[model samples]
Target: MNIKKNEKPQEEQLRKIYTPLWQNIFRGATENQDVDILNILKKVPIFSQLTKKELIKVSYIIYERKYATGEFLFKEGNPGSAVFIIKNGTVSIEKSNKLNIKDVYATLISGDFTGEISLIEDSERNANARCTTNTTVIIIFRHDLFDLIAREPLLGNKILKDLAAMVTKRLKEANEELVKYKLLAEVKNDH
Candidate 1:
């Protein structure tokens, strides 16, 4: 007896994964009116230079979410799926110890984006984000973004460059803060 190859199972599995994601994205978008909020992102330093058309494309892939104060947006080591733009309130980025989150490393306020580092590199989240107040955020998923890049290389390159520059600037500021803290510690020790 001859055995035949089965492609149906693989196709069904893919459809199962993609279908719900597409539906969720569409539902989130329709409910949240993300386009209106995304308009404000153009004023953000990293994305301010993006043209109107570019912004529109980016807007479509973004969805708005609201979190109650003290709610965790993500935890360190969790898989990064999307980058977030803070629309309202603040999010505290904290480092996780073995069993608890501690050391408030950064507070991202309105007009700031977090998790972009993971989008480009497909890495685990480096820190935890918790809502410091009732917060609103706009999220753009990495897979949706990658698809856009495949179709539009120029716009994608511009976004990637801007993201890299933003990360570099943040890193520099963080290094300076570390140096300042180290100096303060040494001064205190001498007393």
Candidate 2:
């Protein structure tokens, strides 16, 4: 169809009117305030000491992932390579006995974190992490963390120190539990 020099085609007019409105709606949906990565990072112990600028840098290297209820985030004996900070929902840290019966070791909720062992070493997971509800997590892969450290040594040092402290604390707690269990076993054996 031929159009007058002063009049736009019907399709062209519709495109001009709808494009900006669609763009705004799309942007709003994708950039919701609840997905603020820096704020989420601040709640995590390893990232608590970071400055806003540093957190922003760290945020660029990390990403968000979601899991459905009953989904396993990682299984015991799987190669672990990333740390996950719970942004929303609950996860169960479970261990399987010799008979393959799973026992829940801990229930982690939003603002809690897990998979920290993967940050320090390349090893198999010691327990399984399964989503108890629809869950969202901030994941930081080992390679990304190393890259961040290489680029920002000061921030990296702080994170490494914090991670070490967390690991030490967890080790102490685990040791205490082991001693308690051993004592219980000894008492039962004597009976």
Worst 10 residues of 1 by lDDT: 22-31
lDDT (Cα, tens digit) per residue for candidate 1, span 1-191: 12236635433443444344322221211222233565657745456667898888878888888999999888888999888877777788777656563656567666666787668787999878999999898888889988987888888888778777866766675566567657756876899
Model 1: residues >4 Å from true position, as ranges? 1-36, 98-101, 170-191
Tell me the alpha-carbon RMSD of every candidate. 18.5, 22.2
Residue pairs clashing in model 1 are none
lDDT of 2: 0.75
> Any residue pairs clashing in model 2, and if so which?
none
Best by lDDT: 2
TM-score per candidate, chains pooled: 0.67, 0.74
> How many residue pairs clash per model?
0, 0
True lDDT of residue 126, candidate 2: 93
